[model samples]
Target: MKTDTVITKPLLEIDKSIDALVKQIELLSFVNPTNIEEEKARFFSSKYLTQPVFKYPDINFDRFKLHRKLFKQQIELIEDERIKNLYEDIIYTYSGLIKCIETIGSGKKFYYNSLHCFGTPTEIDVENAKYILHFEDEDLDSQAFAPKYNAKEAESFFRAYSEQYDFTYHIKHSDKISAIAMVSNNAKTLVLNTNHVYSDNEIAVLTNHEIGVHMVTTMNGLLHPLKIFSHGFPNNEETQEGLAVFAEYMSNNLTVTRLKELAYRVIAVNSLSKGYSFSKTFRLLHNQYDLEKEAAYYITVRAHRGGGFTKDYLYLTGLKKVYDYYHANKNLSLLLTGKVSLEYADDIESLIEKGLAVPAKHITDAYAENSNTNKTVDFILKNLK
Candidate 1:
């Protein structure tokens, strides 16, 4: 360890305890209730083929409840009032994540709990997706980026992207998830779906959004004196994902097709609260919305995967909120301090003043002034109602 580490008194002690507490709060690795691809493949190969009914991975509910109680107890033991409030928010967020995990395998109740956690898409949100549905972009309609690259080739691209920032991480191939980037136990892993072929937009978006923001913040969190910085703040998903999507926009790779995909996700999530079935949601996107059948299948699976995960709707919601924040001339650097939320900008500032946090070691590349390439996408983002 470096000698320059500013080991403040009780704050450092609090940080150590919070860091240890977060070990049991692993969300990204086990967020999905089931391995969706296997279910789909099994359904396709059956003699009597049928719609896939997903079975979630078994989580230790009893063990998690114990962890929850411990986290609550930890929050109560903190001495400083401001520090205590910060931890109170952190513990609250982690507790919500725990509830999401516990409720995953359950059906409509899961949807109800999810809505309680990540709010349901509003009437305007549904209309925004509908408006995006009718948008006809001849350029995006062409499907210019062919799916030709294999897993090894894609891995090379990801490695090259990481190399640009002196980032050290591992790349793994699996058919389990489309593509997910995670930071766990001081190790970083990026998993790719080897079964699906890649396109330029798909590759570029992941490069900027996942690597540029998510990984950047992950590394920055390690630099903090507080462990809560690493675990994330309450409602961090909306801002974190918003920042990731904003990175896509800043890098000049965000497309109408991609934005429409996010819109479709909001629509799919909206269908869940309305009690739409798997086939019903798929038909709503394919027949009614006129999405490609292949695209429709994935969207339905994502929204319906854990019986009713409403989290997908937040991608669009986050994008809008982040966009508005940026346009308002708010400080994006505060968000980059760690896996943080816009709601706690003041808390972060306070930490910096008291030597509990430091400036971001690796500044987000997307935050640099942009070239402003796509006007239409910019216009829509600007006018998102």
Candidate 2:
């Protein structure tokens, strides 16, 4: 049997306090609009010319109190400079998220706040998106790509896939979510869009994408001596999203179609930087790029919702970074040590040495072997600018 690592008393207390405060501020809870389906209907009924009027859930916590409590932690008592610096950064990151939540739907205010938190895509990132768009998409009419499974069936598929690991998480259906599926880190639940019909390949794709890396990290983060791993490291979204998409690649489910979806996200987010409204971005994807209407609308909503969220653009950049890291034979397991960033591998190692962190309790099963057979997809990833 394994023994628990002993973390210092002061550090543990501060970590627990911060964790308690941070638990209430899950950004997804506030950012995902509560009226997605309604807004989508209105958008389509208006012949795709109207901007969506999104409604977000109210902030349930006292933001000022949360901020004060987070900053009042005795971080100075932590003797380790690296650990202290990390805690400070985490506090500021959480504060920034609070500001983001506060400014949602306030036009440029929220966009500027989002820019500070999740930056806009660079010129090279935009070029890479266009490069992927140049490739021919695979046949959508193929038997393997048929949409057959409903939300309940997808839940069953996910539950069965998750049986290989020793973790348990709730699966729920929602009409409000922007994606067909997403994992709630704090809630330990998978939220599936009630209206989506799943393809066999997409089931496999999401199984690895959501459960393989995301829920694996969620469970592993809980096993750590410090709660920061559970909350997240600063700027951890890019790494988390990259690992999830990489899981799809490793499992042989990543297709040119999927890559194009990510590429479209980059294009849509870049449109936000250019001040494109929802209809304009939708036209760029639908009319210019010939993406299907519903597909284009969701991508537009993802970018334009919350007044120009740029986080979607990170998925492609993150995939490129992780793909290179894997080829370089770096320690991918370290990145799996709970909502962590690649830049903080050294800090995670230091935490382990100090008995404040542990190796991931559950590893992404896809990482065990490379099953990808799509050479075209490989060529595209390798050639991304």
Candidate 3:
């Protein structure tokens, strides 16, 4: 006997309501604290001699609490166990996000959410950064370090790639971000840092990382029956970033400098867990390790922002997991099913089988071609512990 499961009308209404509420909670838009520009100026004005003092943006905890109440109420009303678990996962992710917003500027409180949201760097993570630190690259040689394009040039190059996919998005300049793809329910915008110098090849790498995966996933998620796919699953950061970096590799643009940047992020993030202050982390990278003052400052600001951010360490970790999984011949389609988690690939399969989700509308063109021909890069990415 075949029993057909019916989705009730009330469930439909609840899904729509939850989607609207989640859209209202713009995590990234709110997470970049307003004081970054001020602090960056302060740090530079002191000629890298003084610690940065950051001012956090105000978050309305009262509104967030009320929304959480409504989220809990909605979750309680869900009849399907699998769907209920998904909703619960979203609520937990939201709670962590709220904690991150509330704890900004406070060292202890922000570290709590940083642990919950991104996790502390493990001993393995610490060792990986140390190992990568000693790497000598010819690419770092001055004769090979010509950055021909600035942000405007980089943005123009990105536009060509974006046009190929018929992706309509906006480019915005920011003093804070070092080129980020911002995807929300209603907008797709890439924020480029005017302070960072970009090369032609760097834009290609960013094209693959930001637009190829992030923006493609954004458009794909919009075609889904549920909105959670668009917003990202719990801990979607790891897999999404891994996939993006993989795209960079597939397109033959992943460089040793990029890998070193990821390594530096791990070291800086670990410094936070070890109770290092902003100046302490900066000195460790700049004075002790001899990283360029500009690059060192960029790395320090990321980990020390909001007192103790640990999110940057996940890039290397994510690269390892996604590459290992791909090397095993698992279907990439499962990963491209919108902003998803590798942990929940099975759940995504179940959702597709149940007709709750569809196959990706726009697969990344970068991944469609096998162009990563660098063996040394492959060896390092594959062998990372």
Report the lDDT tens digits of candidate 1 across residue range 1-385: 2222443455566667657655665654555535677765664465213667776556644656545564655455556687788777666666666766677767876777677767889999988877766666637634647886777787788788787785687777766563433334245666777677877667788888878888888888778877777778778888888998998988888777788999999999999878888778878888888888678878888787766878888888888888899989988888887888888888888788777788777776777976458887787888789
- List runs of model 2 lying over 4 Å from the truth: 1-7
Clashing pairs in 1: none
Candidate 2 per-residue C-alpha lDDT over 199-272 given as tens digits, one digit per residue, 9 for 90 to 100: 89889899999999999999999999789998899889999999999999999999999999999999999998
Indicate the residue-level lDDT of 270 in model 2: 95
lDDT of each: 0.74, 0.90, 0.76
Error of 3 at 21 (Å): 1.7
TM-score of each: 0.89, 0.96, 0.91
Give a tens-digit lDDT track for model 3, residues 255-274: 77778889989999988878
Clashes of each: 0, 0, 0
Candidate number with the higher TM-score (1 or 2): 2
* lDDT, model 2: 0.90
Give the distance in Å from residue 99's predicted Cα in candidate 3 to where it truly belongs. 1.8
